[model samples]
Target: MSTGELSDERVTAAVRDATAAPSMHNTQPWRFRYLRSEGVFQVRADFGRALPHADPDGRALHISCGAALLNLRVALAHRGLRPVARLLPDPGDPALLAVVRPSRPEDGGEGGGGEGGLGALHPAVHRRHTSRLPFTETEIPQALRTALSDAARREGALLDFPGPSHLRWVLQLVEEAEARNRTDRGEAEDLARWTRAGTAGTSDAAGAAAAGDGIPEYAFGPRRFDGRAPVRDFAGTGRVSGRRAATFERHPQVALLSTVKDRPEDWLRAGQAMERVLLLATLEGLVGSPATQPVEWPDLRWPLRDPVSGRGQVQTVLRLGYGPSGPGTPRRPTGEVLDIRP
Candidate 1:
């Protein structure tokens, strides 16, 4: 723990905190390499776990990695260390999403400490889970909404709680996107590979639920018996035996998280902003889930922007409210995704 060096133990702990980030289908398509000589941690994309058809352009994959990068920053900041990060630092190396150097506070102020103030959100790193279950009809207070909006802004993104008319339009877009996914063979196959219910029977729920990756049966939440809530039915058209069906809220609250641009850097920023908003929401006693169906399709994505200003490209759709915290999803072990430089 010297001024110019970071201990192995501390770096490993930060990686563990970073892996707690949420990804599309829990794919967790990212790797970390500790550059001992440079005293920096590099976040790389693991294309093997990527959904080729669903995320052909790698937008979602980058966003997931961005979330992990954000967690890494928060973990280091909480330890009173400063983390300097660069996104897409090497143009030739596309997989190299970012490189973060954890520096001491008195090291001449090289890096901005990953926005330094994020240390307060360290606890929520593990407490926040994607609750797919139905949330109560309780509307989020205006103050909390404003706070969440600010959280996204601090990370260089926008979080918009669309009005009734806009929400209805967005819901229609989501429904259409879901229907398209239903018929797309590649999309279904990709989803099947990421969901465990296809291979896990009712009796073997324990084993399937223990998997180290993907969406488990236990975390699927209840069937949307009745409501406008946009819960993605991971089961697809297949039925899950013994799964309960529950009525969801009549009017679900949804937020559209977006960035000004749609490049890889923007995607990375959106992911960090997303984690910030989610962490803040958790601290405020709220559970959140992502509805990214519409954003996956190019035709559907453009319409997601605000009609008045006609700016901001939607990256992910988020649903937030009061409800039971969703079941924990597994992540690939640190060794599986991290490589240490000698």
Candidate 2:
């Protein structure tokens, strides 16, 4: 993750490990170019991969990139390279989300998660997937929720969980985003293009003819009340031939990632927290999708911040529960997205 003379092995390892970051619909809208001497990992937003209609303000795009950035950090850590990340280092380089100078644990010490759990999530990285499936009737342990909140807090964000009243507020917001999106022809078209059933993704992993990178028939579950119950319907148009509609759980746990300000730095922080919670949740056998439904709308965005705490701007909402993790979607390979420079 540095510039000057780092080995190709080191940079490639970081990029490969970072791809484990979960993206909304696996957009994976990020590419990294590295400068070896400086140990700088330059993150570029692949606007070609942007779902503009669904994420008009490009917030989810940033969050996805941020998630990738977080993965880069962990990958570096696991490789005995501690990472010193400078987010949005240059305003002139807008696509460059960060520059990481690799640091060894010998320098930065060990994890803030403690030695025991320093990389408790290392295994979960490859295993984590979006779970649109319904969870069991059981509730999540309170202690784990506290731990997830702690993880988010450490990344400069807050996860405001839903109570009955708060849940209602979010349901309405989902409805609002869904309603607006459904009626817009442009939005529907965009979703159709990005959510294709069997088209090959740009990533190497998606090249198999029988495989799928975009949302496929086997996924998409049931219609979330048409307008919105929860979960965005990726296959509502009946693209998948034999895919059946099934029931999701009666209720899904929801949490929001929010930050104090709405600047690029805040967004980067929120994104890292988003990745942390998602990875932590996966390590705990929980799976869910990022519901950036509120962040997509200006009307719903500001109100999403906790009124009392006023802690941070709302970055994302996540629907989480115990269930079958969604099958691995697709990822563009490191070879296509990662560049090494002298």
Candidate 3:
């Protein structure tokens, strides 16, 4: 289909897929605006949903928007259009993270076709979820690991699967970060405001006001009673009446995603890279969860980088293996976040 034939329904569907991109605490911190006249979609950050304490510099916010941006590109590719994304298009407006224009494929037909193309991973857009549940001890195949790394590289980022010693040290940093968050008042408030308690899906009046954007109780997964996997407990110190405790993997297969430079543009690229890795993993029959607890702290985040190479900024930590996919979290309706203008 040509850009001239772009329909409102198509734009809305693409935005819906974009919203499925994971965010810090399921905040869904993004807004979409389609310029019908120009056939472009503006991806903006929703500061109202920002986590000031956890993401003070708005790095995570930008990453979240970047993930959505990648999904939008994938959605467009699946619909037989080629997506051209310009990052941080307007420096004057930092919130306007990106503007994506969908045009006809260069081949004058559907975009690239192959297991490695963006179109190939389009189905995983809706299937991918952040599984916080216990993953088995089975190690991911080297071939699959290489593919996941390539996915990150395609978007200008690096994905590293650390050795045993590095993995252990990274886990320790994650534990330390979690400990600090427990005592940090600001972080505590962020959690309380974004986490839903009581019945899994039932939201109180206060939660209703925010629409469906926070992490629901059911998606929190079981509390970590044993094992060393770096899963952040959204329950905090509070008690969830029926939440059961389970033992996570004794040896969790974790990976660190990083980039050469640390900037708004880099974070956005890292976010896109991260989502690409995730969608590919989902398509490969792997369940994964991202843990930013370590990266949220400056000191801990610094140590997460490679001790040998000592290059690249660690953006986020990921744990992947064979396990049940986590339940889908709440998302704001498409009408709530998208604006179309002629």
Candidate 4:
């Protein structure tokens, strides 16, 4: 896999896989520039798509780009090339998140997981989705939970399954955040601007078909009629015609993803770790969704940390279990997100 040997089609396919990574509000706020001469792809943040109200510090934006970077590595490894990634290669340019190039396996690469293991996850990349629907009551096995934590550790982050007491407290924070969102004008506006309507009776993919970004109506799943699941109601105060109400799991299976230090680089690592955990869970017959409402609010976020340890900064709360896989959200075209230079 030399510089000149890497075909344009391969690069395009890799970028396509990268864009499949989830983001806040499904914004897909990332851009890729392939430098043929250097044999590298630069991952940059698209500030135009940034959620100012929800993520004013751009932490979520960087996390979204980091997930895409991980996908690029997985895609290259699946293609029989070892992918090497360098995070924040240039401090002068903050938006330039990472530089990734394909190398021979013998040449090695950064990150813990081997090329083989990463490639094994390529299939799961596209298979994983944010399922907003209700999940069953079955508890995840201890073995699978351990494996998911290992996946996060390999990416320089921590995924903690809170105890009964801690879990109840975290859920309280989520409820508080939800209450705030209802009254916060700025948060409401962000939700409205990024969410789509007019797909009430149509398929999940139909609402996103026009915008190529944002959460669609059908993907909102049923509104939480009862139960303790922390599903976000994208509809806000408005009503979606023909939408049904359902009770979610009473004790939803949840995990908290966090990093030791809360810096830009750490946020990037958290994002990669988050996606790795998600893809592995999907491969192991699980559907999941990210519940970031608590994390989005500064006051509510600090209380989400494990009271026992209280070590890491919580990045995102994840809900995982056996449930219907969420419908695929629309993604911006490859041409729109990628730029190739000679």
lDDT of 3 by residue, 1-342 (tens): 788787999999999999999999999899999998888999999999999889999999989999999999999999888888899989899889999988877764325546567877899999999999999998899999999999999999999999989998999999999899888898889989998776364554345435587877788899999999989999888889888999999999999999999999999999999999999999889999999998988988999998999989999999999999998777899999999999
lDDT of 2 by residue, 73-95 (tens): 77766665556788887889788
lDDT of 4 by residue, 1-342 (tens): 455678889899999999999999999999999999899999999999999899999999988998998898888887877787899999999889999978876534442245327877888999999999999999999999999999999999999999999999999999999999988898988998899876655564564676799988878899899999988999888888988999999999899999999999999999999999999999899999999999999989998999888889999999999988998888989999999999
Q: What is the TM-score of each candidate against the true structure?
A: 0.94, 0.88, 0.96, 0.96
Give the worst 10-residue stretch by lDDT in candidate 2.
204-213
Q: Which is the winner by lDDT between candidate 1 and candidate 3?
A: 3
- Residue pairs of candidate 1 with colliding backbone atoms: none
Name the regions of candidate 2 deviating beyond 4 angstroms: 1-6, 106-118, 198-213, 222-229, 237-239, 307-311
Q: Among these predicted structures, which one has the highest lDDT?
A: 3
Q: Rank the candidates by lDDT, best first.
A: 3, 4, 1, 2
Candidate 4 backbone collisions, by pair: none
Q: What would the per-residue lDDT of candidate 1 be over residues 50-83, giving only the tens digit for each residue? A: 8988899999999999999999988887787777
What would the C-alpha RMSD of candidate 4 be, to one decimal place? 1.9
lDDT of each: 0.87, 0.72, 0.90, 0.90
Q: What is the lDDT of residue 224 in candidate 2?
A: 45
Each prediction's number of clashing residue pairs: 0, 17, 0, 0
* Global lDDT of model 2: 0.72
State residue 212's C-alpha deviation in candidate 3, in Å: 0.6
